[model samples]
Target: MAGTQSYVDDLSGTLDERLIISSTPQRSNALSNKFSGVLSASYADSEIRDALHSLDENEIKNTAETRRRLRLNVQKQVIQRNGAVVQEYGHVAEQLKRIGAIINSLTACCEVMRQHVTAARHENAPVLEEASSLLVQKQELETKKQLLDAFNKHFIMSEEDLLVLTGATEAVDDTFFGVLMRVKQIYVDCQVLLGTENQRLGLELMDQSSRNLNIGYQKLYRWIQKEFKTLNLESPQISSIIRRALRALAERPTLFQSCLDLFAETREHILTDAFYSALTGSSSGDNQNPVTKAIEFYAHEPLRYVGDMLAWTHSAAVSEREALESLFISDGDEISKGFKAGRQAEPWSAGDDEAFDGRKALGELVNRNLAGVARALRQRIEQVLQNHEDAVLLYKIANLVIFYRVTFIKLLGPDSSMLETLSSLVQSALRQFQTVVSDNASAIQAEIAAPTPDLRIPAFLDEALAQFTTLLKTYDSSLTAASSSVADFKSIISQALNPFLATCEKMAKETNEPSAGIFMTNCLIAAKTTLSAYDFVQDRVSELNEQLASLTSSLVEYQHAFFLHTSGLHPLLAALAPTEDTPGSLLNISTLPPFQLQPLTDAGQTLDDFLPSALMDAMENLKRLGNTKLSQEITADAAERFCEDFEFVEGKLTAADELREIALREGGEENEKEEQELVPLRSLFPRTSGEIRVLLS
Candidate 1:
């Protein structure tokens, strides 16, 4: 039992050793090579030693059996594992063969495919080339299609577009306008097409567009005419669409002018009807507005009648002009664009491409609209002026006409028929005014040529001047300050005012000396005062001033003469008169008999009596002077002249007294008698130049 146990143990150890040797190949190989003949080497030295120690001799002898059995077990394990490996290698070899067969078949198939492709290429060369050409053609066709589509969209207008543009039944709306713009664009773009190689298309399209554009403009022209016929000019807000339509129509000048003519005719009739309504109080048997009195009601008042007629005409003209302006000028930019397009289409429209002048056209239309009323206005005013006898009223009518003429000059240009008619009417009224003035002057010259006995302005002259003043007030208030040139205003003053002043002067000439001067002075003073308020009348006023100065000088001279004569100084003056042979030398009146001491003594007594009441007497003499200030001024001036004459008399007396003294000294008592009578120069005159100057001052 012990031996069997040891043998089992030994077998277990040997199996462990074999597993270790198999795990360590280098050690196992070295051990096998070095210890091949030794039993101890068959097993590991450690394994033999362990066996010897653990086993008895019987058990050790059984080690050989253990070894044999172990060998058998290892060989069987090797056989089993080798069988598995060989079976795996055989399966791999079968797979490699299958793979080789597949490669050969694939190579053969590839060669066959290559040969077939080569043959196909040789057989269908023309077809391949044809296919390539077809592809290029297809691409070109696609590009052409795209270009044709773009060209059709851009440069061509469809028939529907033309229908919208030129159809009379079509409403003038935004779509119609937009289509018109496109058509116009197409028309203008035809020029570009004309510059290309294909001018036929351009020419054809241009002709077609030209006809269509003409038709459209004609339709628009008729449309504008219809709108204008029913246009309410009094409305403040005009349609923007109508304004745009007119701007579009301006491209055709002839058509535009025709439309304007129609509009003008319509407006003329309307304004004429309105004016007639204002004048007669009714147009169609309807009473006029109560607020606006009919001009005919004031016919008895010619000035107010004519004024009302002109006022109504002017108001109507202004309203018409403003309506036309609103219609034309609101779309000025669009109008300019259309005008430029038309000029471009027809370069010969004018040599210059100036823009449409709205201002000038508006003036023409306004003038035309006022034409119907202008004749009536002129005839009515002229008839009133002719029948009126009051120069002032006729002058007022002329001024009213002039005021309207100036207003129409701005509203309807200077060359307008309305202005021309007003001008002729003004001439007619003025002619009538002048005729009345001349006739009045003729009658006044015959009847009231003599001034009043009190040296005042004649009643006829006063009435004429009052009428003249009325004319002046009318003139000054009726026109603007800048309206008339100095020459023209002077002409007006000459016609209306100068005749009365001239008649006054003529009447003044028929009166006596101081009275004539006073009357003329009164007339001139009144004229200057009435006219001085106006700046344009200054020239005539200056002339009047010159005449007044002349008349004042004459009156002063006459008064001075009267003062010298009344003061008993004339004898002294005759004594002191400058000698003709001596040119400037005074007469030696001391030696003259009149300047002798007795005569000088008598002159002194007379001078003493006149000096006491000199200024009062002068005032009484010229008391008929109308202006009191002028009377005082003239009286003082004459008193001073009287003082001058008295001084001369005193000087002659002193000279005579000196002569007397010389005679008395030379021939003792020969002139003593005369010297005693002279009583010295101061005592005889007793009035010194200083005392006389004091009295005058």
Candidate 2:
């Protein structure tokens, strides 16, 4: 206890001295103030200690025990403070372990991150190389684009220049080949530059090129038209130029077609216009007949020109056909092979050959043109026949129609309608001729029937007959040339002449005078002579001769009747006939006195005057019948018999008294009582009795 007190006192003294030494006065004062109370208490404890020391030993033991107890409490507090420090140390150790684990985990994560980054870099290496290559390619494409842009500009410029040079523009030039070459080059270049990758652009460029080519071709066509217009079609130079132009365009189908169309149009215009003018006679400065000129022009120049053009067209078609065949073969089509085999198998017929040969197209053109010309000529001829009364012209026109029909048939084949038109024209002309003949026959008939019949009737009749014969002759030739039957021509002529002859007969009947008979007979004889001259009309003339013979027989009969009436023999004959009262008895000339016969001088004179000049002429005609050979032999014999009868009548007149005495003797009673009946002529006059006795004796 004493030691603890001493330690405590020493600790306090050390603390007081340290305070005095380290502390400022203010600090010492604050410390002194703070300890003041402690010091006072200590002083009191010292006083108490002194008093305890002085009082009793028991108080000293108690102070020691209190020190011991305070020491124990201090020990206990120190132990508690050490225990808290130990716990803090353990917590700090756990914290260090946890921080070490977190660091290890962070290190592992960093390592994994590094490995992934390395793999990514490895995978991206080829991509970066590809990107670098792409950059190079982009640069190249940009350069190429710039080049293509320049090429496009140059190509467009070239196309424009080609258009200008080819006269697609307003500038006209003769550099067609050069322009075509340049345009072709530009087109090929554009195709190359556009490439297959830019197929759409390439197609557009090709279309533009094709349009430009078409424009160039059109310009060439216009140039050809202008040049051709300046040249005469008939000139040799024109043909040469045409050939050259055709050759130039031959390779170009579209341009060639354009030229061909132009040619066709021009040809049609020229031919149609010329034909119309010729047909209408509106053409200028020509002396020849329009029909002739039309025929000549159509038959020659237009035909030749059309033929040439058709030949060219046919050649072009052949070339096109060949090209198509090749294309079809390349395409593996069976049609071309089959068509070729068929063509080889069946050779064309002559007409088919001609049609298929280069001439078919030309034939069509010529046929159409000629048909038009034929129609025009036919119309003109019809007009002429209608307006003009010229028989000669009608005959000529008829012949022309026949000729044209034949020509058209030969040139245009039988299918052509022009043949029908020609046939119609021929018929019309024939009808006109028939009308003319009828009218002329009527006029002649009227003249013959006039009161004082024209002496020129025979002349007119001769002229008409001659004209008819001429027409018949012309028709015969024309009919033969036209492949018409002779029967047809004969029928036509008969139809025309029969009516005219009948009119003449009618006129003869109306007049009924001997002169009219003589006039008609003469006209008929002239007609018969004229008609008989032509072999075609021989039968008609023979028929007319028979009619004349019959008319002559009637005239002779009238003459016989007139002879009997004029001679006064009729009354004598009537008186001599058997009477009804006599029955079988003859005339009793014996009982009757001798009858005195009158001289009848006036009757003879009347008969003589009644014999007209026409009768004399008829007798003269009959007498001339002897010269007509076998055809008139019967009429000649009849005339001779009539003359003999006239002579017999004269002799009978002188023997009239003798003939009466003989008749009276024959009728006596002795002859009447005879058993055998006497014949009338035998009883009146004997067979030996002269012809004079039968009449005037």
Candidate 3:
């Protein structure tokens, strides 16, 4: 078996060499190319080795047979796969044929469809064009429908709205206001339409809206007028409905102004009637409740009567303004907007911007309301002023008128006719007061008598001051703010006190010296006491103090002279008087005849006697001074003057004594003889300045 296997191996080796190396080049190339994708030499060797290892021993021994059987199995599998591939290819061919048939049928159908489409296009050309036109029309119609719907929604007023706007009997409620507002908006929108390029519809709408707006404003104007005719200003509040109507009416400047005029006229009549009712006790409305008694009841008292009339007017003015405040001022912004809208609608109304100020409107209304009553008030007050003869009373009335002037200025503004009337009344009263005062002063001056023996102020001057006191008190008690500066009160002082005091002074000038001083002092003291209590009169008080000082100086001089005369020193002082033309030798008082030792001794005796009672006698001299304190001061001041005179005398006496001693020591016989004739200074005057001060003190 080994020999047989060896021979078979050799044979296999010989067959491999012949097949691989000895082949023709073309065959070898073909064989290599065929196997190149089939299996690599290394891979084939590895597979053969694995197969050999996997085989049992029996299979190894049967390797040749195994190889033959494996070859056959692989060939059979290849044949089966080939048959399967052939069958699959046949099925694929059948499917391709079926797809071709389907494609052919689709192509035929496409050809038919194309033919039909071409035929239709040729037959219906106008229809297609018409259909396209219809589509465009539909879109255009849709757009117009939308625009018309919006126009109807915004621009067209419903029947109900028109009725509310134009209904004559309709109340001026919020619905009326809303309808009016819509109509105005439509009118304004019409203006925008008028501005557009296509303005036919805009013109139609504008005409309709303008007519509706005019009717609406007419209705508002009429309604406001009717309401005003019935408005009771005694009530503090106004209705909101009226305010709404006024605000709406403000859109038509002419109509709004007309309404205000009618309202103001109605209020004027009402206030005038009420004034009469207050004055005549003719019962009106609840407004009469405040004035329980008629103004006529106070007619006996001029101040109270005129005061009541003015108070009533003021109260009525305030009430009327408050009631109408909401109708104008409270709706200022709304009214302004209304006016602005009107201006936009009517260009000519642009200047009506100033008309929207509620404050000014209210003031005008108040002034108009008080117009009729104001004239009557002024006439009556002036009548009362003219009838009264008392200057102080007339001044009080003037102050009353001034107080009302200020009050009305605050309530109705400074420009109101009521304030004008009050101002005129104030001037009238002041003029009459001055006239009455001048007449009274002239009468008193004409009836002037000698001052009383006691040097007291005369009865007429006292009466004048008492009236002045009342005047000052009236001014102080007034409602106006009192000015602290003295200049502010100078007019009143000049008018009330100064003229009367001047008359007193003129009369005093006709009297004797001391009596004139005393009486004038009394008058000044009375005036000062009256004015000193009021702060506004402090300047007058200071002036009176200065005048008093002047008079006191005069009294001091008088008292000093009295002292000199009482002490018998007047002649000595007269002798000692230095004449401007006196020669030098006689210039010395010792050389003068009155200063001789005998004359000095006699004057010294008189002064010594008078010193004990000098101050008392001086007090007696000025006893009529109304101010006792001033009298004592003048007496003391005079005593000081008396002491100064004694000091001067003592100085002269010492000088004369020194001259005499010098002559006795160093002079000739005649000089010594002259010195002996002159008395010693101690013997000449017994009184010293210190003793005089002690006595006076």
Candidate 4:
């Protein structure tokens, strides 16, 4: 046992030591050259030691590294070889199994194919039993066919043979087929046997065509001589062509088709016109546009079907023929047909007669196709508008406007044109009148003749009216606001003058018109009256001049207020909010800002604006009034009266101010009845004209 263990240890030491020594490239190479000697030496022999002793430590380290790497590579190869062996074993098993299955499957397929082929072969073999019966049936059929063919080939009859058979000895228009039917009826009626006469009649009833209809009958006939040509008995196919040609001759064009084709296109237009007439019940036209004519048609319908009296009458304005002509007829045959077809055709669906409910279908409308036509019309109009322009444009627009206003309005309904209906009616009437008279040469002198609108007077009127109304509103509002200010000032003065006047005489004297007062009244009145009468459209075009007076007075007041506020003279006002400026204004009056009234001298620079000039003018008028009063000996009297009047006005104003302030602060206006009890001022004043009675104090 010890010896065995020692050998094992020695073997391990030999491998370890050999591996370390052969680590370097030189030592490895040396080992490889002596490989046979080293391997051949016994495990216990020292010859292996002699080979290893040739290696150094560095060499040993390299040899050991190489051996470590080589051992790992050897381990990997052993693993891969084992894996390959396992995979091959699995592959062999699978292939063997698959081969067995293929053989078994082929055996099954061959058996199936053999059974199918055998069954097919058995099914193909003819059977004697069915053949016998089939032969019998075929022979029987051939015998019958031969008999029929013989009868077809030889059949013939003469005219005389038909007299007794058909019971028609005289000539008749009745057909031979009809005569045959009569003979058959005789058999049905009598149920009796007759001799050759009965047979003759049946033969005769076979008809004239029946004689030629026989097979080979033409070949037997002498009409071979009629053509004065040799018969083509060799080519039977030519005989079929002849037969077909005869049939073609028998079938001619239908009478209906021939008549209709002659009038197809013409019929369509005629039918279209007729349909339109049925829908509208009106006239044939010459060169009138279809749309225009359709529109005019409704007007004429009463005359067409209902007679001249009805035709003369119309649903529209009967005053003139042209008014009836301008109708708005939208050309949609579908809707038109639906509406009118009811009265003309079927009363309704589900009625007694099928023909009553018989209009073709909804398909005929072709809304898309009609829309295309309308689109084409629109494009044509646009082209004419673009190219011909001045001449065509005005004419087209006028005509269309006439149609819309006159014809369409009246046609749709009495109230259809109710929107601006009056305006439309008036415009249409005017247009028609103008068209009639304007185109004709005037017999009168030029000065007396009225000018008609060969132009679009109404359209221009509408556009101008729109602009005029807008501006007029703006001007009117401004004028109204300014008038309020002046009236308030005048009221204030009048009330002041009243307080100082104790008697009628004093009242008359105080109220006399100051030079400025007359002018102020006149200015205010001029503005109010003129603005009130303003017409936005054509009626009073000249009235625009009247607007200037109101504009002036209002502008004056606006300027005065602006002056007082902007110049720091008064507390409450600035340039009144300005209207936004735009171009083409008849007046640049819109851009002017309200001016601050500089004191008479401070404003001496330029009083081009309203307020300053107005104020100065009022002042000048007052000064002139004062000069007129200068001749009065009591110039002081006038001055005193002015002060008195001023003070009285001031008092009244103060009273009004206090009342307003009370209404705001404590609503004392509500307590007026309660305050009425506190009055004591009237008792203090004595009846005047007593010259200071001694007890005056």
User: All candidates' TM-scores?
Assistant: 0.75, 0.43, 0.82, 0.19
Against the reference, the lDDT scores of all candidates come to 0.76, 0.53, 0.78, 0.34
TM-score of 3: 0.82
Candidate 2: which stretches are off by over 4 Å? 1-265, 272-360, 370-383, 416-421, 438-460, 479-485, 490-496, 513-517, 559-635, 639-697
**In model 3, which regions exceed 4 Å deviation?**
1-86, 124-164, 167-176, 195-201, 234-236, 283-291, 298-300, 344-355, 479-485, 579-591, 668-678
Candidate 3: give the clashing pairs.
none
Q: Which candidate wins on TM-score?
A: 3
lDDT tens digits by residue: candidate 2, 1-697: 4643554576578778877787765564666776776666654468757644432432333354564685575577679989999999999999999999999999999999999999998999999999999999999999999998986665664645754755534544435555655665677677685656767876777677767766765676777776645544443233333444444443353454465555545554544455555433455445445344443344343323223322332333233333222222223223323333333323441122221222333344344434434455556556667886766557666775676566556555676565777688778987887788678766766665542354123455556666677777766666464334546666556645665666666656666444455556666676776677666566677788888777666655655544455544344334444323332223343222221222234434443454333234335444423233422443344434444555543434335434544655677776554424423322232222243333321
| Ten contiguous residues with the weakest lDDT in model 3 | 578-587
Q: What is the lDDT ranking, best to worst?
A: 3, 1, 2, 4
Top of the candidates by lDDT: 3
How far in Å is the alpha carbon of 148 misplaced in model 4? Answer: 30
Candidate 4 lDDT score at position 168:
25
Q: Which of the predicted structures, 2 or 4, would earn the higher lDDT when compared with the native? A: 2
Q: How much is 325 displaced in model 1, in angstroms?
A: 3.2
* Two-way lDDT contest, 2 vs 3, winner: 3
The C-alpha RMSD in Å for every predicted model, in order, reads: 11.8, 32.4, 8.2, 33.4
What tens digits encode model 4's per-residue C-alpha lDDT throughout 35-98? 5564565845576444344332124333446556855755776799899999999999999999
Clash list (residue pairs), candidate 1: none
